[model samples]
Target chain A: MANVTAVTREPSSEQELPHPYLLFLGDTVHPGFAKTAFGLKQWAPELCLGQFALPSAQIDLGLPNLRPAEARAKGARALVIGVANSGGFIAASWIPALVEALQDGLDIISGMHARLGDIAELRYTAERHGRQLIDIRTPPPRIPIATGLKRSGKRLLTVGTDCALGKKYAALSIARAFAERGVDADFRATGQTGIMIAGSGIPMDAVVSDFAAGAAELLSPDAAPDHWDVVEGQGSILHPAYAGVSLALLHGSQPDVFVVCHDPGRTHLLGDEQFALPPVEEIIDLTVRLGSRTNPAIRCGGIALNTSKLEAQEAEALCAAESRRLGLPVADPIRGGPAFDALIENCLAAPASS
Target chain B: MANVTAVTREPSSEQELPHPYLLFLGDTVHPGFAKTAFGLKQWAPELCLGQFALPSAQIDLGLPNLRPAEARAKGARALVIGVANSGGFIAASWIPALVEALQDGLDIISGMHARLGDIAELRYTAERHGRQLIDIRTPPPRIPIATGLKRSGKRLLTVGTDCALGKKYAALSIARAFAERGVDADFRATGQTGIMIAGSGIPMDAVVSDFAAGAAELLSPDAAPDHWDVVEGQGSILHPAYAGVSLALLHGSQPDVFVVCHDPGRTHLLGDEQFALPPVEEIIDLTVRLGSRTNPAIRCGGIALNTSKLEAQEAEALCAAESRRLGLPVADPIRGGPAFDALIENCLAAPASS
Candidate 1:
């Protein structure tokens, strides 16, 4: 974290980067692994200049294919590692391409478990070329354990049924919707892509376990009485692997209201399909019961379903049915309309218990 | 964990250290901060040769007082850091004394959040002296995310109502009782002190939040059909700050049965007294419901009450009353008499629901 490591400093909050990026997809064949690129292209399309990937890569951003030099020529200031490679390591085969990008006059950025500064080739190349090697996942130094104190202002966190569903999208959409309604709100990111979009957040999963809750507390600090910090959530509490991160975020944020984000199409938990996803009703019940330790007035806002697979008519019918059954608003953020608007209104309704 | 840091490598399981120790109490006044020392003295007294503390320190182990050279002459090989400093950082005031220990030809062992090898003076001194600077809280590398696959054999985890109120002691005692009963059982350490005693464990708090449960899985892998891993627990499920760590351990261990460890006299949580402790009934209910995600047959073993503050007669009466009322064995581990034996026996009584 200091003199021994190549990178000398950790970002205090969200890390900033050069605009107009060339997204590096590496050799990712699975679309899930290339979420970073997809997220950035979706949320900050204007900043993403082009896309680059190995020939073996199967997924695409549909942006122009450009080498680092070509992107640099088109005013791209950085080459962002857009794909989350399996095992969180920079693949040995991908080194030459990363080195080439550095040599082509662009800064390099990554959000992997392994630090970019630890890679000798990339570290040396960046130092020689005077370009930055930024790691977005690094949490700030001296994050104290959470006090469990209820902070000022309103908070709406996006809880989920599983990982990589629609938590971040739901949070971003809710924050945007609040803004459009002339409500003071901010999108509080908690992952790599969201951090890139919002320019700040604590990577909840990357933090040491003991300080995970504390980091969440820091991510959305106490605000004004009427302001809302729309907190982007991480893994689901029902998830076997990452639930700890999810629980920590829950306890630390102590959100007054929460929305369940789910991929209605997914029958089972992501990664390990042996277990099925808990229903939205179960998520709301548990989030309230557990979150009450910090904020006794905790309530559920509604359900945010990622009905991306269904046809428009089918999706609307499904939402309507689910809404009727659960007695709560349900909508896909991307398919924003009356349903989505109702969700925004539902979020602000005080005494809104699930 | 590799070339970038002073320690060239990480252990795959619990870190091992030289035996026959001098416990370093630092300049601590609160006994709570020196739990490592207290736990070791209680569980592995034979390995503790003497106690070492600064003049300002008020807590004592009641063992022979010795300097590094004196303890070394008395057959101590490692100077164990007994105190967990308030901020988890080694104070500058304690440095000169630590240096004196390193100069006296013994390894310096610690379980602090900050790495001993990261401290320039200590790192250089250890390097010059060719002595190990052991950090017991270092977790295994390449800890995979938990799959939540239930493993072979029976497991009993010591869950708690709060931190440091006898979870480790209860696990150790239960495992010992199992051994005495001619049952095949292994004590799985989850914290620093337990690691030092058992010679292998994953420091649950030190793991990345994403892999906290994964690390717990590695700590007690698949075992024999008749074997029982008495997995030591960490934070409480009701804890605002550390419940994530607790939940991860719970899901990863996936204990068929669990015992609730609590301090009977405490009205509120340890560090933060703003919140009151949730009833043991609440812990059992939530644990069973949430734990059913990975382990549908999860059951409560009993209650382990740390009744150290009460008189002997009062403690026995209180435990007996609680046992009768709750229909679950309740006993103080330290006072291992009839009640303690019943608690241990009840742990094996299958279908032991709360």
Candidate 2:
């Protein structure tokens, strides 16, 4: 396993921040909740207290849906909004429960686009209870405009076919794989959940549009030449709703090598039904071409398949077919297999001269 | 001339703003002052009052430089800092003159990256005088994250080789040219001077990095099908100092066609002596390919040459040679020529099947 350092924010001397024991608030029906819970459980098991679901909701992720009072009683210090819904607005129905948590002196933390601080009631309750309302989606302070200058060290980016198709997971997995091989690799998060886990990185989407790429550039400034920055990617170029963010990330990362993350079962681009997903080959070509504009040696290092929806046998066959088709190492990094090892080997090897 | 509409901010009813007779604060030695003055004269003639220069400096842009006292006495309501120096900061030497203008009750306006409001002395003086200090480079209120949705109507973007290489001039000239042909074309400014003249536009570089493209997208939302948006480009893909801005503009504009802006004499990319400007053909290819990732039909419509450094005869020869070589219309749009007409025709013509 990689020697992952959890970079937490410095607490004020007067009031040391409490270590968060999160009570994830989302139903199993919400894919966002599942994904968020899964990510936290896999990457940050220590912080996750348990899930908090409605009576009618099923607890499928194996985490118990503790009662709000029980959660707080069991050391749940923060109510983490795990649902990644469209527009990022918190559901009105969830407000009453969240208010109760705030009143009970539990801090509120969410990665949603909607800020709990923006809601007067939540802000008032949090203030009254001396509970912190942390909005993870807010952009970090004083992000400088990107100069697009080359920095020291090797960089690898995980670009995906669409949003939330496992770019972060692929990056993390790769970093883990690299670590297992005794390679010096670091994970650089660019989005909310990743930032929450990494404890740093610009919430790129929350940032003003002009500086998105600049923020990405800031993440991996000067580094040791032998070190590898496994930078997590954001939205997809084919994603009509978030392509600008994707482009900014692509340009900002300036990676020497990139792994294309793909969800083969995704028929249409998320948040955009009218457009169909372009062939993986087309996306790979586009990513490499656009990325190479800044770093001429940039190329597709491998392919990280999100085979969560596929059977093990089917996923293996698909990976084999893709490996043959693209002439690149292909595998689901999350699935324990030789694929992750092969991917690490491929990236560490010298890239062919373009 | 195109039916240019000045989109000025409404003054508060409690404080009726005075008509700004600007005292352009820069000597003839500073190209920024001359260019800002020239752009104002060409586009927003009604807004121009006069210039401001040091006693030892000459005013060569044909505008009379009034002394701080004379400028205010002669109806100058604002002191516009027009010297676009490296890093866009006002020099310490200019502070005394600026302070004098503020003391004389002139509001301060600047397009520099440095904020006059951030300077303690300037802020104190402006507050004491109840004068507004406007930084045109400050980002607009409530710029949404870009959806990358296909908006109605056609867009034509002017891309360039480097910063200050005439992307704005080329865009304006094309819009004017289109208007002469009875075409319904609009100029969408993405920089401060363009915003100043147009009376509306986002100072894209100042926007938080994420929303730069979103701001550009908002500029021409739901326009007529035949209406052409001549979007002003910022920086260059080859320019190390500002390529992030350029990429944001390129992706944000989402143009169906683009005119490549080139300053032929710029051997090295601006601000970075380590890198040289790639060939115009390579840039054109890169732009089209990168741009096509969003709108597949996006192509280079023509070439707008910034032949300001060349003599009339030399410019004409270069334009002709480029037109023949690239097989695209090429000319200095500022100089009276058929190049603009040729460009419009080329764009309106159905693109070849890629």
Candidate 3:
């Protein structure tokens, strides 16, 4: 609300503001404007700042030791943090309790404000955008769910065996698909990556930061109803200690649909069967474990034939067949190019029969 | 101490044992067992029937949530929770805090315990092993550290321009170097991946759950002093979140040195000539911002050549020269084959100075 300026860096007004609110949901850290600005400006000028949304976050280093009262004095807001690769996040264990407490109507804070309960009206906002659950809330010391409650757009989740399996690409493609479907989906990384808004149709040129400043404005209620979409990327598997931390951020605000991205070549392990990644079955199992079973989680569709591994016709046939088997529609989002765009539109147009 | 009996299918003998004591020390996740077993094994592993140590951990489903009373009721033993990727890990943050509180000053959950005014006793130990760290402490529900103590262990921040440029690989290699120097350096996903340790090491076959069990024993002080060195395989940097988190686990344990892994290929693109990774640099900046500047950090080494990218001879020469320049006792930790074994051994060796 305070002009949405960088807490540390000097704000650049003339240079289209980094779509601090455009969540770039993916596993791999997408390049930030500073990095993407290197070349390809002519064709993808939007990738520079105004036309794209980067996943990079700018962390507020000064807030680590601030008490809730002090943080409040400093205008600190409540947050809903998500870790993409839970098994691999540095502060992984702290997430669940933080999310749980917030879900149970407790105001979670750091060492300084551990006891400053109730002063901050914080909640983890979960919105169903497109077909996935998008966790667009900021990290603690600033949960932005209440303000942006009205703008809950699309929700997307990308799952892979690990970061190497190309979940990030799938997330971006899904975000693109949602945009083409006339839905506003913001890419959100739940783990270590910075924001990335490549391909097309984004808020700014891939704004990247260590914090969730990208979707900061949209996270509040005062923001316009731009019909947003969120692409939430996860770093790695969520382990037990603080098991449901990430999902808790989505507790009060669950997504509409949950799409699991699988690089068929990798997930199916070339159909070796035994090598299925993230063990598709296990992911579905874990969602229930984290208590998200109540939400309608359909396979929706998947990305199996990566251009790097399959032929065009083969890719088409693979997606089409998978959709047929699942009694749903699927597309390449990226490889199918514009035609793929049509497929996504059709899927979104279909009834929410599930 | 209790016997660490091996069981079939589910092993809970040690986990269920009363007065369970698990001793953890340093960041053993990298060049250690956790990284090796991760992604390969299910989150559940009956850590010693009653008390056991995990090489590394992240918030997960299998992690048992023990309240303060539950932890204290277990009694007379300690569990050394080592720093995983950075800042060291908290089994379940509050769980450890609760454990520390319940122990009534006779336990060491993590560096937090140290801050909480608990006595710093035997460094490490494991069940069945006659190590003193496991024998002399009471149980948990304690706040290892006081309400406001800064955590222990090294915190690694990554600095790099983009992925594929070798930042993640560089980070892993550096973590290994620090471990060799006896500095418990923990890693957290920072910027776009640069160099990673994804596809290297003993391969996935060596990652059976049984092996992890053995590893936990070996890392315990009760085991042979040289146990960790004899173990095979090392951690990988497959995902950014996991990589960073694991790195942080290592860092929090406070190793003797901080090594920055860089890729000569993108030395210039990395912004900081010193570390060669933007995230690494950002980490350094963040650390400084967090107000800890006395720690010694270094740009120890990196991967020199990829066959398609550079001549083999040049890559080898550059790697050798860099190792030589640093007076490093080992060669390229990332590229060398079995020779990497020596790298692992060297990484585990305590630093002479520290």
- lDDT values of the candidates? 0.86, 0.73, 0.32
Indicate which candidate wins on TM-score: 1
What is the CAPRI rating of model 1's predicted complex? Answer: high
Model 2, range B159-182, lDDT digits (tens) per residue?
Answer: 887677888988888888788888
The model with the greater TM-score, 1 or 3, is 1
Question: What value of lDDT does candidate 1 attain over all alpha carbons?
Answer: 0.86
Could you give the CAPRI-style class of model 2?
acceptable
DockQ of 1: 0.83
Which docking category, incorrect, acceptable, medium or high, applies to candidate 3?
incorrect
Writing each residue's lDDT as its tens digit, candidate 1 over A10-94 gives 3334345566789999988999999889989988798899999999999888999999999999999888888876678889988
Q: How much is B136 displaced in model 2, in angstroms?
A: 3.1
Model-by-model DockQ, in order: 0.83, 0.30, 0.01
lDDT of 1 by residue, B34-144 (tens): 988998898889889999899999998899999999999988998888887666788888898898888897788777878888899988887777777877777767898
- Chain B TM-scores per candidate, in order, are 0.87, 0.82, 0.29
Query: Which parts of model 1 have CA positions greater than 4 angstroms off?
Result: A1-15, A24-34, A49-77, A87-105, A352-354, B1-15, B22-35, B50-77, B89-105, B352-354
Q: By descending DockQ, how would the candidates be arranged?
A: 1, 2, 3
